[model samples]
Target: MSIEKFIQDGVTGWMSAHGEHSDIVMSTRIRLARNLTGYRFPIAFTEDDAMAVDRAASGVLLDTNQPNYSYMKMSEIPSLERLVLIEKHLISPHLANPERHGAVLLSEDETVSVMVNEEDHIRIQCIYPGLQLEDAYKKADEVDNLLESELPYAFDESFGYMTSCPSNTGTGMRASVMMHLPALTITKQIERIIPAISRLGIVVRGSYGEGSDAPGNVYQVSNQTTLGKTEQEILVDLGNITSRLIAHERQSRELLIAKSRLALENRLFRSLGTIAYARLLPNGEAARCLSDVRLGIDLGIIQDVDMSILNELMIFMQPGFLQQYAGTELSQEERDVFRAKLFRERLNIANAPASLEEDREE
Candidate 1:
């Protein structure tokens, strides 16, 4: 079955399995490449792409039944074959290390290294909690029923099955989602946020939120290691956070813009201009946060066709992801303009080309 239906009923089952004691759990720890330091890369989508993925995370959020986000989860086929394909772009040649497992870690020219493992219960990280932990708790079977009771078959066969990570058994869905909250995380008691997030059944750790929590403004929330939650449920939960954080982030950015200072603006500007990348400037021919939604739809990573997702994606633009996701690099001026304006003309959506004429004729 397609990922959609498999996830619909499956995730609800997983949510019900939350408190089941038989869940085999394991610890998870991964690292990013030390080289990735900039903020802009794969640029955010434009008003157009925002229209495409509107307020949702992916196309998955079109279903209105589950307004609560975690009603669904994200699932990608993580098989050896799939890994080989993704490795071509996302990572380097595979390592034959048994101890570290068939670990695949690589970044674009060492800018970002991804330490991912299925058994680690961390395909990525994310979270979902209610007014209290007890209120949020559910049975493990609920999660499993909604999550298809197995990892995507495609990912399982190729990546091989792993059973060591305690937190990655059962539902085996770890969603590492990042949400901007510069308003609360940056302005408040830089220390108290950790305790607050921990109380939510979510762990905040490092730039990516690993073991213990850190001063995370952009939340990397996810299910605990080897906990029971389905892809459907995870997506639903992620949607909830995505909406809330996007709203908060917008409020914070407005606060910054309204209270722009010589020192802070310069710091933000300098941060954009001072990237040490070998290719200092990226070409402006790719999808931009404000442009390209009218042009290349494939580059739209956060496409769910919702206003909330679009708003979040727009605010989430750091210089690094903007450049990386976009096939071309960006100039310093373009970056600043993007910051000042919510949308800019980054793509020539109206330009006619000989290639397009040929396609039409065919």
Candidate 2:
């Protein structure tokens, strides 16, 4: 039997049963665009640093009077170790999940009241019941001064000196959140909600954040305000949108779960096929383990050659090693030859013997 085909078939069977994970469509929140008046600062951070900043921004770090960024732990990514903390931060909590806002400092004197900056624009953001509209607006304005000071040199030329992107020249703050609501969209009633949300300065995008979703199951809510509404007024309308976000998430969750279940039917899913094929291999896990040892020995590749030997080498072992003193082994040369052959075979598909592919071609 073809080793590759067997592995594929076995893996497919196993995964179909386990691959259909129970899904939950959650409401995701983030700051989008804003009126950046009286602000001077850097543009977006590097991707890695931005992600770290994203985690930091969700929590309530500073209180209103001396509102500033609260220093939290460094980012988990080791590569960005020397990176300085970005000025913005937040703390998000859901009615059905954790509820926190802004990053509060754990000071040496106490566990609060430290500041990261003095000026920036503020905007309220919420996609659930726990954070009320009043509190959301209040919290947003607290950080209005963060952008007043000097920014990193990176923001100097391309996006600098009050001539940044045309839409956000002053008070550079953008607010938005992810919402899932299909029933309204499916029944075509969503068109009605759009005019209302648009009137409130909100723009909606499709699934995964862009383009239109004909099914209208998911949407990203973002700001489109240009009429000089106060942060309070903007959030009042936004808060109205957030309050309705929960209902949308529930419907989306059910649809996703149903979709996953259908993907699992009849072993058509790739994940299921992979597992089924693995189990059906001739040596099963054991045969491959022996072959690996043989190839390693042949290629003169010892444990030192591949630092990834621990878990990967023993991922799946056959029953023979424990039963017999003779374990599967290969010389260094053998391993090299095997690898070369695999590539050669792949390149010369027509050279393969009179097999199934040829039969089909005929």
lDDT of 1 at 164: 39
- lDDT score, candidate 1, position 237: 61
Q: Write the per-residue lDDT of candidate 1 for residues 106-191, one digit (tens) a residue.
A: 21122122223322221222122211112122322232223323223213432222333434544444444433344455456335
User: 8-88 in candidate 2: lDDT tens per residue?
Assistant: 211111111111110112233323232233333214323444333334333334435443333442222111111101101
The CA lDDT at 22 in model 2 is 8
Q: Number of clashes in every candidate structure?
A: 104, 74
Cand. 2 Cα-lDDT: 0.32
All candidates: TM-score: 0.35, 0.33
